[model samples]
Target chain A: MTRTVPTSPPMRRSTVADQIRELILSRGLRPGDALPTESVLCETLGVSRSSVREAVRTLATLDIVEVRHGHGTFVGQMSLDPMVQALVFRGVLSPGDNLRALREVVEVRMALDLAVAEKVVAAAAGETHPELRALVDEMLTHADHGETFLDADRHFHTMLLESIDNQLAGQLVGAFWDIHTAVLPRLGLALPEDLRQTSKAHGDMLAAAEGGDVAAYREAVIKHYEPLQRALDHAN
Target chain B: MTRTVPTSPPMRRSTVADQIRELILSRGLRPGDALPTESVLCETLGVSRSSVREAVRTLATLDIVEVRHGHGTFVGQMSLDPMVQALVFRGVLSPGDNLRALREVVEVRMALDLAVAEKVVAAAAGETHPELRALVDEMLTHADHGETFLDADRHFHTMLLESIDNQLAGQLVGAFWDIHTAVLPRLGLALPEDLRQTSKAHGDMLAAAEGGDVAAYREAVIKHYEPLQRALDHAN
Candidate 1:
């Protein structure tokens, strides 16, 4: 006899999870603070040990809690891992067709990059971000090296995002960047042929950042994406 | 003897899952397309039945695959459910005191809303979206109704997002909106006290959309957010 398990939902509703989450919030537990023990949670919530355990497991998966061996569970640092995973699956599971979905990711990235550029420029106020400058310098060095220079590129953007001091925006942008880098390779996509142009675009952005010019930053951002736009246009 | 069963992740890594995802992509399986039988997947992937089942469970949890009760598994529609869940948890589990996290959510929403408004104005080109018009009208009717007019507000924003024909951006905006709505109640935050001002903001946005004026739309978007900004400012 084949006993079948029911199809699970895309997102299952979890009463136990909600209760535990509430407990964390209500008690003001910090990221590293230990949650109540299983027995205590079970008794307090009037649920089974298995249910309590299940709830923590779910929270852990969502990056909301960390379960340590013997030490007990603690609240986890917030992360974009879950969002990144969702985007990866989105790209992977997309039916073979036009690169519309991947292109959408690019479009969102462009919007975010433009926003970050403006914020960075306004905040810098004619001052230089040494870190950003260093990254751009490294990018120039690696421009014609036939390598992706992905690390410097990523750090430059990440630094820009961090400078804004907005964690949520950073996570959203990081998730999309992760998706773009991950999906592009799978689709047999490569960087633009003219690497020097790419490095020059970064330089322009750096200059705009130092000059506190939002308009120049915006133009530089558009220039930076030109190669990507060209690549996407060709893919289409 | 305390033998510990490692807490299972909300999403566990599964090589079989990757293989199965690749299989779906390689086979050009669209959403709702059924997959091979359990026996076939096991045979083809050269994995144990348990591994295949576990992988499928992981995929289902990720919303990458849908499992039917007895009809076998199928590709699942791409969703922002996971991202929304992550954002919700981020809000819920935040250490109290600073609304920085919540404020960040608002800022991201503002950026996306601006983008959405621009796109809607460009696309409509002097034509009004009736659904949006109706929502604004409803807001006006409820201006003094002492209700929050939250539903109409959400619909107006959601409708604007959908009109852009970008599912990814819409899903993203929708996710942040979900996070904001879910978090605000928990924080005991309320709408601005002046209902008329709120209604007027929406009216201004509608007028801009109808008139195909991007600058006016942008101004209206900023004005519409003033209440929320004031609320956040008061909280801070």
Candidate 2:
């Protein structure tokens, strides 16, 4: 009898993995949902155990699946911290384009800043955190000293996130500033006027936040980023 | 004699490394430009070699500093792919409210989809590639076939990217999709109209591209994701 033949698929491991992922997506597998055992996957996918394991490993890296010490692999949900770090790591690899790159970073920053301010107002209805208030005062006090102004300014913007109490967001935004400040001089792009203009945005944000005027708060935040955008555009 | 014990100045490795990075960003240090070496950094920063090396390593991980095995570390250019992957990873990560996370990801997708459409039209404006046309037809035929559709669908969406002929953009977008399709379910969302709406977006995108209307192409792409935003809202 002629031996039976099968597809002899290439990249069997990847195929098995995609199949598994598809199942998870469609079936709404929870984090702990037990996948069919390794042996079962091998038999079903017509692949070896090693191939199945490799697929599982890749998913694990993405944190979409987890392999426990004693238990079998299950769906995973990792918060985005590790993933975010990975992105900045890769961002730095690009060739000399700090000027443009910084500008791009600022683009997202402006949008995020506006969103942050709006959320704070919505959540708090114009109440200000004392710390945020103090930081605002500090911004005004040090306004004439550019370096001092910038430091206090960085803290104040960060405080807005702190006021909202979204730790994940605070960290993400903070990370961006950490990077921006770190790369600023290398890009050799700065506009004192931009910083001065930014102070007004802060003032506007604070006023709107205090008044609990959601519309004004949103508009203020968006306007705040205008100078940053202009500065970035000039850098570009 | 009890020497006056002095508080050690905070390790300035990060500061030094940052300065070097600034140089890279500012265009003072072009990609592939050799760094002054451990000895040089030490002299410039008034720090120890170990500190310098640490800073270099930090930069290396940032992908800002590339250490050639023998030649030494040099200033590096930036690549958008790595940077974008980093952002998407971070964005998904440390995600706050489930709704916001989903909304943010979908919003980003909308932006990128516009970019992809524009690129596709720009690249494929004058003529069509038979391969691309075939892929679209295959996708149209396989629509609603689930597994089959998904496979062809990947190709079809990917074709828009290929139309741009920009490998880095394709890679970055591909990475986002990797994250997208992975958590497709836990995301507790899909287009309100589901695949039908997704298909409509694809069809409209292709139509705009084929007709060579850049603005219309972008508009169609932007509207295509409306279902995605609705899905997120509905889930919330």
Candidate 3:
């Protein structure tokens, strides 16, 4: 007796780009894994070379597929770069009422940070984040010199979520931070007077986490955003 | 006396796409605003038509620009569509260990919902959400019949964020929900048996919000996700 195997139809029957994505998924390809050649993909998917190339380019924009100049196509890093770009564009487009967009970004960031406060504090129990402390100290040093501590500030926020297992949340935090930095200058707003106070909030957050005080960590998170909130209000 | 005005250099001077984005920003274009013709854009940016087309395609992929078949290109909606595509692709790519991705998605959703618990409750204080109540009733009706209530579920969550003045948060919530639904079937896991209980949690959440009880609302949110968490644990 002969046996028959059943095959399901394509999950999403839309675009050539989606078909390419389906090919990637069906092949169980991981990031950095090499894909078939362009011509091979064309033959496999029954499409023209230009169609395949267009699909590839679109996928590359989404960071779903990586194209190397000398090498060949491969699975992409699958980063949140697209989200960051879209957000930055949205923030940029709303030049007149950009404060609304900026406030939304800050509010979402604050929500995410606050939601993870207890988990972050729990993860910090019996563990000392020397890197976090060092970042805070670096921030304070920059504050004392009255210079912006952008690198340290970015790293400090990134490090805060290092203990959490959720990569999406961390990437989101970083993406919002990127949007804030990218759009802030376009508003032509003045900096808050107390850079030291904002810098010290980072230290307070670290201390609260190290001490396993969720309430304090939550308070520090709010305090960290207070300066920016005030600055936004001042701009209004 | 003659005076010279200083011009700042381009912020991101890498790609033609970046140049096009800068052009859009410099012109203060809004969504649905028409862009220059292809040849005009090429001349303005001092690039070839092919280069301009490529940049436009890239921007279109990011939803920064929109292109019509016969009509000219305009600014896109700048939605979280790119993020949704990236997330859905990411979730689909990791088929073998998809539980991890699903867990992250759920965690982030829970975090956002919890983070907005108080605000959502406050927003619903004086407002009667007949739509929300109807959705809960629809969910319960579907559960009674052993059917899935996907549309009502999605609408309910989307409506929960409607009162909040954060478009990004709402879009993110919708994006994550889309990912969850898109990737869940691929896991080949059985649906949990407590459909009515899960459906009832929606009602619980609505009641808590209507009662202006933040703590109860928070509890309802946790209860809402408990079934999925248990199912995941069982799968593990």
Indicate which candidate wins on TM-score.
3
Let me know the DockQ for model 3: 0.37
Q: What ranking emerges by DockQ with the best candidate at the front?
A: 3, 1, 2
What's the lDDT for all of these models? 0.75, 0.57, 0.80
Query: Per lDDT, what order, best first?
Result: 3, 1, 2
Q: Can you give the TM-score per candidate against the true fold? A: 0.88, 0.53, 0.91
Candidate 3 regions with alpha-carbon error over 4 angstroms = A1-14, B1-14
Select the stronger candidate by DockQ from 1 and 2.
1
Worst 10 residues of 2 chain B by lDDT: B1-10
Best by lDDT: 3
Candidate 1 backbone clash number: 0
| Span of ten consecutive residues with least summed lDDT in model 2 chain A | A1-10
Candidate 2 lDDT by residue in tens digits, A138-229:
66656646533556567766666676645545555665565555445434546445555667677878778878887888788778678766
Better of 1 and 2 by TM-score: 1
RMSD score of candidate 3 (Å): 6.5
lDDT for A77 (candidate 2): 56
Q: Which tens-of-lDDT digit does each residue in B1-236 have in candidate 1?
A: 11221111123455788788879888888889999999999999999998888677656655678888878999887577656666676775562648777888888888987867777787767675777777888888898787677677777777777778677888888777777777776677665766777778988987888889999988988988888888878775
Query: Residue-wise lDDT of candidate 1 within A25-122, one digit each (tens)?
Result: 78888788999999999999999998887677667766778888889999887676766666766765552557777788888988877766667787
